[model samples]
Target: MSATKASKLYILDTNVLLHDPKCLYEFKEQDVTIPMTVLEELDDIKDRKKNVAQEARYAIRSIDSILSKATNSEQITKGVRIILPGKDRDIKLGCLSIFPDHELTVRTGFLPIEHNKDNKIINCALHLQSTFPHRQVVLVTKDINMRLKALGAGLKKVEDYRTDQLVSDVELLPEGHHYLDTPFWEGVDKVESYQRDGKAYHRVARTLLPNTFLNEYIYDSTQDFAARTVAIDQESVTLLDLGYQHLMNQSAWGIHPINIQQAFAMQSLLDPDLDFTIFLGSAGSGKTLIALACALEMVIEQGRYNKIIVTRSTPPVAEDIGFLPGTEEEKMTPWMSAISDNLEAMHEQDERPQSSVKYALEKANIQFKSLNFIRGRSIQNAVVLIDESQNLTPQQLKTIITRCGKGTKMVCLGNLAQIDSNYLTPLTSGLTYIAERFKDFEGSASVHFQGVFRSRLAEFAEENL
Candidate 1:
C-alpha cells in the first residue's frame, strides 16, 4: 500500500496483529496505536505451539525492535517515528504509538474490567477516538463483533487492515479459461496447427487470448470444442497437447477425468516440470480425489516423488470437534476422512490385486501430517497436498510453502467459497491469495475447476439447497 497524502489513525486489535504481524507497517503515512491490553494478550499467547503464537512473538519482536530506537518513554507512549521499508526507499515515516488502558466505569452493555479482553481493547479505542478529534480514528480489526461494538460506541470508522484483498466478489475471480467468444473458426486456416503424439496442437496470437497465463486452459465452444493450453508466450498460445490429455482418461489409481478441468488438473499434477499447482473448486469438485490419484501415480507407479505428505488446516469445515484420540495419524484420520473415502473409492474401482485403500496407501507411502509440525523441516522428494487450504492464514501458507525443498512438489487444493476461518473471506483466503500472487510465476500454475464431478447429488446440492 502507498502512503496516503492525508493522515489517519488506525488502532490495532490483537486479532489483527495475530493475523498479520507486519500490520503496523501497513498504515504507511498514517499513525498506528497498539493498546497495552493487546500487548498483554500477546505476551500470554507467545509461547503456544500454533501459528497464532508465532505471530504474537513476531509482533512483539517487531515492536521491541522499534522501541529500542526510541530514546524515551514519552516517545514510546506519545508516539515514535516508524520508517516503513519500501521498494527502493522508505515509503513514508510514520508514528507508532502505545496507549495504556486505564480503569474506568462500566458503560451500558459493556463487559467489566479484568474479565473481557474485547471490552478492554475497545475501551482503549474509545479513549483514542476521544483523543484524536481532528483526525480520523479508525479501529482496525478482523473481529466483526469488536468492530460492531466500536461502531455502536460512535467510532466514526472501522476497517479490516488487509488492503491486499484480490477480489471482493468470488465470481469476479477468473476461471483460468474463457470461451472463444469470437468466430475463431473463420480464421482457423490462419491459426497454426501441428500433430504431436497422435493429438493436435494449435497456436493462436496472444492478442486474441483472454488475459491468460502459462498452462491456462483455453476452449473453443463456438465450434468443435478442444481443451488444454500447454504453452504460453508473449505473442502466442499453444493448445491442448492431447499427449497428456489422453493420459487423463488413462487410470491413475482407477480414477479418470470426467471433464476438461479435471484433465487439466491431472495433467499439471502428473507433470514433472510443474512444481507448484492449485485446484480451486467447490465441494465434491473432485479436486482432492484427483490430487490423491496423481500423487499415487507419481509416487507409487512413476517413482517421481519419495512419498505423499497429505495435510490440511485443522479448522473444522462447519462442525465442532470435542477431542480426538490415538497417534497423530490416528487423530488426523477423522480430519482426513475425505481422503480416506477417495482412496477407498479409487481402490474399489481398481481390478489389481491388493487394491484396498489401506494397501494402496501403504504402497504409495502416504503420510498424514498437521501443518503445525512442518516448521523448520525441509520436505524433499515428496508431493505435498494441502487440502482445505482456504482455512490457512496467508502467513501460515507462506511458512508451509517455504518448507518445500528440491524435488518436492506442493499442490494446494481448496474452495474459495468454503473458507470457514474467521480471519478469511473469499477475497482474502490463503487459497485466493496464492492464486493471484503466483499467476505469472514460472513452473507454477493455478487451475480453477468449473465443474463438481463428485456425483449428480453433490452437484445438485452444491448448486441449490
Candidate 2:
C-alpha cells in the first residue's frame, strides 16, 4: 500500500531494527517509516564482528532489497518506507534539541548512556517523534525509562511492544496429609489406573510406601489419588514434587513441568498470540531444559515451527575474544556449551549416545546464534529460545522480539538473581521488565519456580546462597 494510504505511520526506532532484523515486517500493511538517520546510524553497527553487527548488516541488506522491489510495486513489499523527515519532522527535533539527547530517550526502550550507540538510537527516536506530528506517531519500545522520558517530554502515546501478555498468577493452597490407616497399597501385581479430584494420575510400574506421619505423602497405584490432611507451607519440598508431577504429566503439550517455572514458560510458549515469553530461574532449575524440551516438542512433534533457534548472551565477565580466543567458534564454544549439554541429556542415552547431540549441532537444521549477532534476520516458522535473557538490556530484548515473523514462537529463559551485568539489578533487568510489562496479556504468562529440582546439593546451595 502507498505510505500515505496506510492508516497508521510507524517511525522505525534504531533499537527496534537492531533488536530484530526482520522488524521491518512487524507493522505489516501499515505505513512504516524508517528515518534516513536510523539507517545511517545502523551503518556504524552493521560492520562489527559480533552478532549484533552481523544482524544489523542482515537487516540493512534485507531492507535494501525490499526498497528496491517496492520501487516497482504499488504497495511496499516490506512494511518499511525510507523517508527523510521534512519541515514538519524537523520542528519536533527543534523543540527537543534543547535537552541533551541522553535526557530525551524513547520510553520502554533501551537507553544505555554508558554505550554511545544506544544514546544515538534514543536520540533518533526522539527526533522522529519531534519531526512527525500529523501522523499518529507512537514510540514503540521495550525500555520503560525511555518511554517515561518520551512522555515527560510532552510526547503522547508511547506504547510497549509487548504483543504478548502474561497470565495471572494462579493461587494455590496445599491441603491434605497422608493417613496411615488409609494407606492401602496392595502392591506389585499389575499396574492400575488412578483417579483423584476429577483428574487421572499416572500409574507407576512400581510403588513405594514409606512410613507415614500425619502430614506424610502417599499415592495409590490402583487409582491416581493422594492428598495431605492440612495446608503445607512453601518450605515443603516433598509437596512441590507431588504437585509438580501431577501438573506436568497431564499433557506433553502446553505447559509441562520440569520444575515450577516450566508451567510459566510453557504458558508463554503455547500462547502464540503473546509477543514474548520471559522465564527466569536459578541454574539447575530446569529453565533451559524445559525451554529446549518444549521447543523441541513444538517443532518436531507438534509441527509448530520449521526449526529451533537458540541463542544466549555472552557474560561480560568472560575474557574478550582478543584476549583468549583461537577461532570464532572456539571463542563461542564456552557460551554455547550449556545448550549442547542440554540437548545431549534430552536424547535417549543408550540408543543414540551423547555425541549424537553434538553431531546434530553441526547439522544446519537447527540454529545456534549469539545474542550480539541476531540483529537483522526475521525468524519465521521457528521456535526461538533465548537463554541468559537476564543479561539483555531492555532495548536488546525489544530488538529481539520485534524480529519475530509470522508463525514464530519465542521463549526467553534466564536467572534474574544470577545476573552478571554491572548496570542492572533484580527488578530492572530485561526479564523482569518483560514479566511486568507483559503480565496482563492473555497469550502470555510468567512463572517463578520456588524449589530447585536438579540435585540435592544444587538445591541446598541455591537456598543458602
Candidate 3:
C-alpha cells in the first residue's frame, strides 16, 4: 500500500534561540515556526550585557533582516522564503513563519487561552498540529521542563536543539589518552629506540587501532610504561620515548604528581615546546594545583617567561553586581580568589622552610587580569593561565586565544560539567570546543585529570551529591 508522507513542522522555543542565534537556519528543509511569544521573550533580554542578551539581540536582528525583504507580515503567515548563503548555495532553507498564539485552535478546549508564555507557545504548536492533521509537529527546546509539558499536552517529537552538540555522548569525549591491552610490548616486535638532544624516540610497527592520531598517548599497564605518537602515517607510528618511572619521579614547585593524569599535566605544563595546553577535570581533581605549580616553576624557577598572567570569564556575575571602588587589580581580587586559594595551597605545601606565600607571588611576578579589555592587546613573554574557562563561549575563547603573542604559553583549566552560563552546554562549551579542535595541533597537548586529592568528604560530594 502507498500512503502520502506527512511534512514535518518544527516550532522553536525561546531558549534555543537564546542559546544559539543561528538555530533558525539549522532546520534544513523542515518548516520552522516561531511563536510571537518567543519573540516577546527575546525582546525582554535583548538589552543586557550578558551573553544571553547578546544572543537574543542577534536572533532578533537576523529575523528582522530576513523579514525586511518579505512583502508584508501576511507573507510570513503564509510562509516566507529565506536564503542561506554559503559555498554550497543549494542549502534548502525551509519556510519560516511567525505564528500567533491567539489563533491556535488545537484540542478545541483541552487547554485554556492564557497570557502565560509557555502555554501560549505550546498552544501555537498545538494549533499547527490541528490545522495540518496529516503533518507532524515537533517542539524544539533546550529546556527540559518545557519539553515535558509539551508531551503532557499530547504533542510529539519534542527534542533537544542539537546543532551545537560537539559529541554524541559525554563519556566518549576525548580523555586525551588511552590504555593499551596487555602484551602491548610483545606486539611491537620491530620497535626501535633512539636518542635525540638528550631526549628519546621510538618507531613501532605494531597493529594499532585506526583512530590513533598524532600526539596520541598509549599507556601499558603490565609494564607500567607510557609513550606518545610523535608522527603517524597510516600503518606505522613514531613514538616519543617515555616511561612511567621518570614521570612519577618528577616534581614541579614542590608539588608531586598525585596520580598518573596529574603527572601528564605537569609534563605538559613544563614543556616549553608545547606553548598551549588544556586541563579538564571535575572538582578536587588537582587540575588547577598542578597547573599553577608548573607555571611557578617555569616562570620563577626555570626563567622561561617574564610573569604569570591569569584571567577567566567574569561569570556568575556577567551582569552588574554593584559598583566597586578600587584599581583594576584590586577590583579583580574577589574573582581571583580561586587563584589565590591554589597559590596559597602551593606555598603551604612547599618543602622549603623559608617558603612564604607573599614571597612566592612576588617571585613569580604574577598578574591577575580581566577579560573585559583583553581585546586588541597582544600578550607576550608570559605564562597565561585561564581558570574556570568553561564559562567562555567558543567565539569568546577564539578572541582571547588570538591575542596570544610571541613567547607566550597559554594554559586553560576548567570542568565542562560545571558550566554556569545559560548560553552554553557541556558539549558546546569553550573548553570542550578547543580540546576537540586542537587535539592534533603540533606542540599542543590536553590532559584529563582523573583523581580527587582533596578531602574524602569532597570526593563523596562530587560522586554522590
Candidate 4:
C-alpha cells in the first residue's frame, strides 16, 4: 500500500491490465483504483478466443473473485473495485460536437479503442482526478500516447507500466573502438590476441550494450573482468568440452555447435533466479534443442528443477488439435512434434520410449501444456520452455512470465525475422522486446544466431535468397 501511504491513487489503464492481469497484486497492499472504462474494455475482450482476450477475461474473473470474497459485493469482484466516475460528470469541453470521432479521439493524441470509447475513458479519468484534489492522482497506462496525454492534461503524475525491465543504472561506451588485453581471454579458447586497427575488442560479442551514463568508460576491463565491448558478433563456431577426457566420457549434449548456444543460454537462464528468460533465433539456431537439453540437465542431471515443462503457442501460431480429434495426446499430436523432434535429434536415437512427445510426456512426467490453460496456475521447480514466442504480443508475453512460480525457469524462443503476425513489427514483437529491455541486466544475456547452420541449402536460401 505504498501508493496509499503516499496518498497516490493509481487509475489502472486497460492495456496495463491486459499486459499483466496480476499487476493488481504487484502493488502489494497499495491503493489501486480501476477505471470503469477498463472494465468495459475487459468485457469486450474476455471471450474473443485469443490469448490476450483470454487474459483480459481471466484478469477480470480473478479480480471479481477477490472482491466478492472481501466485500461480499457482487458489483466489485476480485481485487478491483470498478467505478464509473463519468456517470455524474458532463463534458466540460464542446470539442466533440465540433470535430469528427477520429478528431475527438486524436485531439488528446491518445486512443486505445475507437474514437467514442477513447473519449469516454479520458473523460472518466479527468472526472475522477478532479474529485480527488487532495490525493495525488496518477494515470498508469501501457499505451504511450495515453500516458503523454495524461501528463499534458495536468494530472499529478503519469507513467508507463514497464514490467519487463526495470533498469536502475544506465551505462554507455564508444562504438567499434574498444580496449582489450590478457586475462580478457581467460575462460574462452582459440582467442588469438590480435587487435584490428581502430577496431575495439570486448572478447564477448553482442548486438547492443547497456546504455552509458555519468560520462564513464563503462567498458573498463581492469575494474570489471566481465565488462565486454559490443563491437564483435559471436560467430557460428564449433566447440568441444574444455576438459581433457576420453572421447566416450564427454557428454554428447555439449558436442554440437548448436549446444554452444544452449550452453550460453543455460548459463544466462540459471542466473537472476527469476522465472523467465526468452531466447530468440532463426531455424537451426539451437533454441528449442538447447532449451530441451538444458531442461533435461537441470531436471535429470543437475537435480535443480523437479520436472520438464514444454508448451507452444497454438496456431494460427500453433496447430489446432481440436479439428484432428482423438485422446488428449492425439489431439496435441502435431504441436508436440517440435519437442519430440528436438529430443530425437538431440539423443540421436531412432528408437525411444515413445514416438510422440505426448507419449513422452506421460513417460517423463513432463507437462506438455498449451498457453491457453496457464492463467491462474503458478508453475514451481520446473524448467518451462515456450516455443514460437515471436507470435506473442508484449501483453501475452507478460502474462506467461508472471505465471512462473518460485524455482521455475521459463525459456521463450522464436525467430523475430520469421514472424507471421500481421499486427506486429520486429521492434514491437515479443522476442526483440525482451532482448532490448533485458540485455543489460546482470542475470540476462541475448544472442541472435545470424548464420543458418541447420543445412547448407537452408543456409544458402537464408543468405542468397
Candidate 5:
C-alpha cells in the first residue's frame, strides 16, 4: 500500500465542519475524506438564515481552496496533497479526497442507503474500512449518537472532534477563587503589608499559592478575609485586601449578594479596572441578575458606559432571527428575556414593577442585539453582556470580543451544565475557552457561582436533577 493509504483515513462529518470550519486542516499527516452527503448537507445549510450558514460557507470555501489545486477528477478521487499555510508550507502532510458516496453500491454489512444522512456517512466509512482493511478508518463527528450508531454498525473507529477541548474533565477548570482550609495568614510564612494609592496590599511569597493567577480571589474558611491577586512574579504575589464584609456589602441596582461566590462575581463586575469578566454557574445561580444589576449601575448610575448591549446565542432550533417580526431588537427580545426577567427582579419591590423595568430599560439605554449582526462593528462606550455564552464556539466569541472598542466592558454569563449546542460540551465551550485564556490577564476576572438562589425548588433541582 502507498504511504497515503497506510495512514488513517478520517471521514469528516457535517456537524464537525460547522463546529469548526478549519477542521479540514487540523488532522496532521492523516488523509481526510469528505462524503458526498456531507457536502450536500453543507450546501443546503450555506444559504440558510442562521449562524451555522456562515460556518457552512466557510467550510465550503476551505474545501474549495484545497481541492481546487487538483487538475483532474481522478486526482480528486485518489487524493490531493494537503498543504499547510504560512511558514509550514514546505512540510508535506496528508491527502484530502471527496468520496463519491452517492455512486456507492450497497454491499453486505452496509447500512441501507435509504437511512438518514448519518447512516449514509457511516456507510461511506464502512466502504473505506473494507477497501483498506489493514488501515484505520475513523468517523469524526461531534454527535454522540452518531458515534454510537457508527460503532453499532460495525465501524471500528469512531471519535468526537475534540481538537479544541482544553480540559478532559470539567472539574479541572479554574473556579476563579481558592478556598483555604485554614486562615490565609496562618499558611503564609512571610508577608509584607503596605499601602499603594490608599489601597492596602499584601505582598506574599509566591510559594504560598503556587497555582495563583491574575485577579484570582483567595479566601479562608473563617470568611473574615478576602483578597484578589493584583500582581504576580517569580518571587511574590501582590494581593489587594478586599474585606469579606465589603464584598458582601457591595450592591448593584439594589441587589445584594447572598453567598461568597455571588459576592466574588459582584466584586468582579463592579471593578472599574476590569474590562472583561466571566460568570460561570448553574441556572438560578444569579449570574444574569448580578451581571445585569452591575451593568445597570455602571451605565445608568456611574456613567462609566453609555449603554448596555445585550446579546446571546439563540438555541439551534430558533437561530433564524430574520424570520421573526419587527426590528432587530424586537426580534432579539425573545432570546434575551432573561435580561428582562433580571431587570424586573431588580425592581420587584417598587410600586410599579413593570413600569420600573421599562424605565430601567430606557434609562440605561439597554439595546437587545442579535449575535448575527454583532460582527465587524466596533462597540464603544458600552457594557456588552453575552448571555448563554457556553453555546458559542471560540471563533464566535473572538469575533464578538474583537468588536469591543475603547471604554467597553464585556461580561459573559453562562451555565456550562445547560449548554444547548450539540457540537459543544462544557470543556469545549467558548466560555471555558476565554476563562482559561484570560485567567492570567490583569484586566480580566472570572467567577464561578456555586449557589442556586432562585428558589428552594431550583436549588433542589440544581443539586438533584
Candidate 6:
C-alpha cells in the first residue's frame, strides 16, 4: 500500500489518540499522518501522573509497533504499510506516515507556529492540504475549536473522529424500556402464558416489540402491568412477569423507589443474575442513591458480595491526587463525598445519624478506589459502583470493566448531560457506548431515570435550568 494510492489522507490530533489509543487501526484503507507536534505532545503527556498519561503511553506504543516495521527514514516519511490482525489479514489498507512539519520551509498560508500547539497542528494540516491537493486531505480532531480553526486556515476537510461514535444523536440511545399506551396484553393477539417454579412468564410474537433488547423493561401507561424481557428469539419474546406492585414495593436498605423509573433501576440493581447494569439520568435523579443503597443491601444484608468497590473518573487535570494528604480512600474522600451524602440520606431517620452512617460504611466493607489505580487487577466478589462514568472514553471504560472477576457485579452510573470531559459528548460518551453495545447481552441491563427526587428546588432547577 502507498500513500498516493490511498483514497484519503487523515491527519490525526493528539486528543483523538488519547480518546482511543487503538484508533490508528479504525481508519480502514485511509492513510494516516501524525504531525511531529502530536508526537511531541504525547511524549510530554506520557510521563505525567494523570489518567490520560496511561492512554498517552499506550498510543505511543501503538505508533511505535506500527512504524517499527519501516526499515528507513525515507520509508517512514513516505508511508509504512498497516497490517491488521486476524480476519482483516487479506484486506489491503493504506499506510501510516509521520509528517516532519517542523522541517517545512514554506510559511505562507500557514498559521504561525508560535501561537500555540493547536496552531502548529493546524499549520501541519494546512501544509498537507496544499501538498496533497488531489487527495481528500482531512484533519481529524475531537476539539470543536480546532476543527473551526483548521477550516479558517484553508483546510478543505475537517471532521470529528467518529469511528468509535455509535450514534450521532444521544436521544436515539436506548432508554432501557419501552412504553405502551395501551395494556401490554391488549396489543398482543396471541400470547402464551405459563408458570415455572412459582414465576410467571408470557411469550409473545417478537414483532410486537421488534426493537426491544434483552433485559429491557416493558410497561404500559395504565400502571397495572410491568415485565422484563429476559429472552428474545426470531419468532418470540420471553418476558418475566414482574408485577407492578412488586416493583413498586421493592426496597433496598430501607430505601423505597419513589418513581417507576427508580423502581426499574432498583430491580436491575438487586437482581442476582444481572452482572452488569447502567443508570443514566440527571443529577438528583436517585442514580447514586439507588446504586449505593443496593450495594449496601447486597454486601451487608444478603452477603451476595464480599465488599463494594467505588470509583469514578476525576477531572483530567486533577487526576494526579498524590499531592493530597492521606491514603487512597482518604485522598478520594473529596471526590467521593456524594457517596457519603447518600449514605447519610439513608440513615437520616436513625437516632444517631452520623454513627449509623459510620456503622453502615464499616459493615458494607466499602473501599473507595481510584480509577487511576484500577487498571490491571482482577476484582472479585464485589459490587463495583462507577460514578461519573460520562467523563470516561470507551477505552478507559473497557479498562475498568475488564477488571471484574468471578462473583462481581459492576454498576455504572452517569448523567450524560453533566459530562465534564472536554473530549467527550453525550453521543460519544462511554456510558452511551456500553449502554447501546450491551443492550443485547443477556446478563446486562440499563435504565434511564427521568424524575428528580433530590428536592423540590433541585427538581425545578433541573427542569428550568
lDDT per residue (tens digit) for residues 97-199 in model 5: 9998877735443777675888889989988898898789999998889899899989999998888777788888789999999999888878899998878
Q: List the candidate numbers ranked by TM-score, top first.
A: 6, 5, 1, 3, 4, 2
* Residue-level lDDT tens digits of model 4 in 231-266: 322441211112111211324234333333343454
lDDT of 1 by residue, 77-181 (tens): 877767766789866557787876654324432345667888787777777667657777788888888889888877789888676676676676657655677
Per model, state how many residue pairs clash.
Answer: 0, 36, 0, 16, 0, 0
Better of 2 and 6 by lDDT: 6
Every model: Cα RMSD to truth: 3.9, 13.7, 4.2, 12.1, 1.7, 1.6
Better of 2 and 3 by lDDT: 3
> RMSD in angstroms, candidate 4?
12.1
**Cα misplacement distance, residue 381 of candidate 2 (Å):** 0.7
Model 6 TM-score (2 dp): 0.97
TM-score of every candidate: 0.88, 0.49, 0.85, 0.53, 0.96, 0.97
lDDT of each: 0.76, 0.56, 0.78, 0.55, 0.89, 0.90
- In model 2, the runs with Cα more than 4 Å from the true position are 1-246, 250-264, 267-275, 317-331, 358-364
Candidate 2 per-residue lDDT, tens place, 1-465, comes to 233555455555565665556665556445555545567767976764443565578678757755663444334423334443367672111000111233344443334445554345445455655556555666666566766876776556676554332222212111112333443435434434556665443333322333222222344432344432112222221221244345346344233565333544554465444555566667887777777766766666677677877877777655244455566555566777777777777665547656666554543256766665567788888878888888765667877888898988788887877777544455546676676665434445455555677799999999897
After superposition, which runs of candidate 4 have C-alpha atoms over 4 Å from their true positions?
Answer: 1-45, 55-255, 258-262, 269-275, 317-330, 350-363
Window of ten residues with lowest summed lDDT in model 1: 102-111
Worst 10 residues of 2 by lDDT: 90-99
| Alpha-carbon shift of residue 291 in model 4 (angstroms) | 0.8
- Residue pairs with backbone overlap in model 6: none
lDDT of 3 by residue, 98-153 (tens): 88765553445345655567777877877777778788889998777778988999
